[model samples]
Target: MSDHEVVDEKPEVESTPKTTETATEAPEDTTAATPKPEGNDGGEESGDDMPPLEDIKYDDETDDAVKKKRIVIPEDKPKPKPAEDGWLDVLDNGELRKFVLTPGAVGQPRPERGCIVAIKLVVKLEETQAVVESESHELTDMIVGDSDLFQGLDLIIPLMDQKEVARVVVSSRFAYGKTGIPGAIPPDASLDCELHLLSVQWLDEEFVLPIVDRIRIGNRKKERGNFWFGRQEYSTCIQCYKSAIKLLDATDEELESLDTNELKEHFDQQMKGEKKSPEDEERVKELVDIRGVTYNNLAMAQMKIDDFSGALTSVEAVLVTQPNNVKALFRKGRILAEKGELEDAIKVLKTGLTLEPDNKAIAQELNKYSAKRKKELVTERDLYKRMLQTDKSSPPTTPSKGLWGRSSVTGLGVECNC
Candidate 1:
């Protein structure tokens, strides 16, 4: 779920569903930083328009062909003709087709990969044109490539311009895949969509983006992670969380190192945050919140997939920023317990309990790990001690050679016992 305020729903047409989720940020790459543009909505065209329909063959011989592909508009049905002033784009033998009803605003930025996009859309069955699902203009924020979107939408979104409204038809192979959503959509149904691109957020452009925009982007990613987590997709969930962490990672190492009181206090306040606002301090606080939650969620998801080592790393990231974060400590303790590090598990659980004195889960974990450690210690102690003593007391003996120069079973040897 992302913070995209959902206003309505229909038969599910969009590849990714609308969710109300807060997101997290990733580290910035400024290697090719461009000058801050005048507005957020505008970009160079994707240059991804495939060859004309006549140039493509829908038969099985085609590369990345869709088997038993369904036609978007049957030969007899009326087809949309792009207005001379608008954008018409197609790909993959018509698996993806975009006909822009409204041209993008002049000078508006077109979203690219790694950008966050806000969109409103309704999906329908192509033949019947019956609506399946719709997210209202209130919108949903989708991260371009990372959204776990259907292949067609994934390919089409980056080519869209902010505030541009278009009609999109994605084939079954790129819509819901071969096995479509049960009850909501029939198998092999191409999705007919009316898409609205409301805005875009450039994560890497530092100067052009307002702080609030960045905060929203990070939080949206966090919520997207939650969406995947809810579906029991642990790997995808972890990826969403890590993406947020990267977005929220401190961009200026030197400034963070100054150790100024105001800066230190602000960082501290992020964990114990103040009221939300749009100012830098408030935005920073929001980012920290998103980062902590993202890491915590990442650790939990990793644990689900039995990636205890990775889970440990994720939780430790939270612990680095918020040492007393009980959730991180709890997750770390669980990861350690999974790794059979009962001692470390017990220690972390104990620390967490001290922080949240009334926490019963931590208390239980502490008791369980402590008992396990005690059991292990008691079982191994005397046995290892006797073996050590015997080894120390006994002198080593060399094997005597047999007739064929091989070591013999009756060779001279030493035996030791308690």
Candidate 2:
């Protein structure tokens, strides 16, 4: 419940109560607490497997009463199955379950985190099977990564396809929870919802999409890169990361659209003296975070195949988005050293060390590159000094062989005139 984003505590649709926010990043953390807004870059950890079915239990029939009603299956009759066809048991103890009413597109891919999806939900309180009151226009679309819905939906959406429709029932832990919506949802109320997956767009035609959606898609790509990296497929990992950065890359024109000044100033301020709805600055932070993570992943993949130049470029991009990213600084240092730019490498590693004085990786790399540079400098200096010591007017001379075809030399170890 803490991991997914749920609908605002006070759902705006007033009638349509928000369920848990879904997108599969684990409950997908919940609370419409992100006020109105909203990286898992690693390979996603699968949730605990759905628990096995429970043995039959007599309802209100104690052990003594069971003897009177002995319910037995005939030996010839097939044993009753624990499961019902077409239903997905989502969590332990039957906290959540789903039955698809309509299958999705044939071979349609499941949405990853950060997708912009169109969905329609018909929600009702489980106890009464009465519709939850909300504004009719609520819950038409969602960003899979942000919590503005119920936690159960977070876990359920990934199992759906484009244009798929399903019925999901979730207990209070995933719905309004113990802290129910006042005057609307009661405490400990379970919810029944019919969800329609209208459509999804991840990469193509992403310009007009919400910033949160773009960031989510970028991070999903980074996670894919991590998967490829673990498989030792450096080239594939690099490609995945490249695509991710492209998603995070916001052009100048995009910035103008985000500026409340030139555009949405009226709507944001018109409602009241206090700004109402639509958080733009928070989205910028999300953008920076995704850019940093994606560029860092890209740099690492390039480094794996000794693509030092490319790695340097990628790491620099991370620094631009996140100047203080220690991992980026470390990577940049290494790439510089590989390119024989030790002085620059040392400077970067030093900057990283300042940020994390206890970081062993940065310390060791800094030492190794610094030592190599020092040795090269000393050798060059000695060659230049020896050249300066030689006389410009000095004539060349030939050496004579002494005993075993070795050159005869004086005490100074130079061939002598004798």
Candidate 3:
């Protein structure tokens, strides 16, 4: 306590002068600060108030930074306008519209030029929706690009696929032009058409081969023909079978040149070299058999349509390869019978019965023909006998001149005297 008191007394007296000297220096410092730039003063004031630069974080991944960093942008994006329920602008022009009622089969075949298409359609006025012409229940078949359809339909149907349903609107230019549909569609009237594409089929060989293996394609045609035949659609059945026959190349030249013995020999050689499978031989045989069957089927369909001459030709074609085919022989006989060639019909039926003696159908047909022939012979014999008998019973009519030069009944009573 004694030492602190002595030191405090001496220091306090000296410190008072030092403080006055520092106070005098402060005025000089203030005068120098006043001359400093105003910008520097503001900078210092801001720096003093703000947090340290190192302490504050700056985001490197903000949206603004990312936007500035991007370089590429796409141009001309397509934006489709929403259409009304069941309606769409197919061409993005008001002139052509499509309203889908029922979706079609996926990946179905569309009609192409030279293809045959079948459809059910209904035509109406676009403004009034009044029915004009309709084919609703039955399918109308047309050969694409060749048939006489409405100009609008010709352009539009080829764009449809099988089993598809839609209503299409067409402007006057695409429809029946200035002429319009007389007594039905008015002049320059926009048409609303309901369409159902039932089928698309190509009859051209070159077009079909690329889509399916030749044999399988022919088989499918054969099956379709049989289906139509079962439904008694003879015309359609004949067309289908003809298409199948064409695909098989069952021509006179081809059939004549096809030698199964040669085919078997070649197949045997290939088999010996292990280059051919048993299926190859089987396929060859099957192709030959299919050709014969197709001919027979064609003949049957022809018969149903009363195409007797055509049926005969087809049956003869079958018999060329399979002379003993029961069905071919029966069909040939039936066709001959229809042509009134009874003798030839009997001969054919007898030949068929020789091959298949147990076939009741052939036997029955033969018996019926035999009975008919006997009846005809009997009837003719009776007719001839009756004619002779009648001639014998009836007196001959003649005008005899008497002495008076007048017609007299000479055979009455005076015949004995004469």
| Cα lDDT computed for each candidate against the true fold | 0.66, 0.67, 0.65
User: Which 10-residue span in candidate 3 carries the lowest summed lDDT?
Assistant: 2-11
lDDT of 3 by residue, 1-418 (tens): 1121111112123631222222112222232233344555433222223223222333454643232322233355464433867566655667667776777876866788767677888878989999875322344445555323444666667666578898989888766556565677788889888988888877745342321244675666676666556646567667777867766653332233345323333334423544434455455556657767877888877877789999999989878777887888987888998998888899999999998889888899899888888888899999999999998999896667766576666666663222
Name the runs in model 3 displaced over 4 angstroms: 1-157, 160-212, 251-257, 260-285, 394-399, 402-418
lDDT of 1 by residue, 101-125 (tens): 7878757677887776788778889
Candidate 2 Cα misplacement greater than 4 A, ranges: 1-206, 251-279, 390-393, 396-418
Q: Give the backbone clash total of model 1.
A: 37
Model 1: lowest-lDDT 10 consecutive positions: 2-11
lDDT by residue (7-103, candidate 2, tens digit) is 1121032643434433222453444323221122343432334221222234455543232322333255352223668677766468888888998
Off by over 4 Å in 1: 1-111, 116-118, 125-142, 148-151, 159-165, 170-190, 197-208, 250-282, 385-418
- Cα lDDT of candidate 1 equals 0.66
Model 3 global lDDT (CA atoms, 0 to 1): 0.65
Q: Higher-lDDT candidate among 1 and 3?
A: 1
Instruction: State the displacement of the C-alpha of residue 222, model 1, in Å, after optimal TM-score superposition.
Output: 1.2
Order by TM-score, highest first: 1, 3, 2
> TM-scores, in order shown?
0.58, 0.44, 0.46
Which has the greatest lDDT? 2
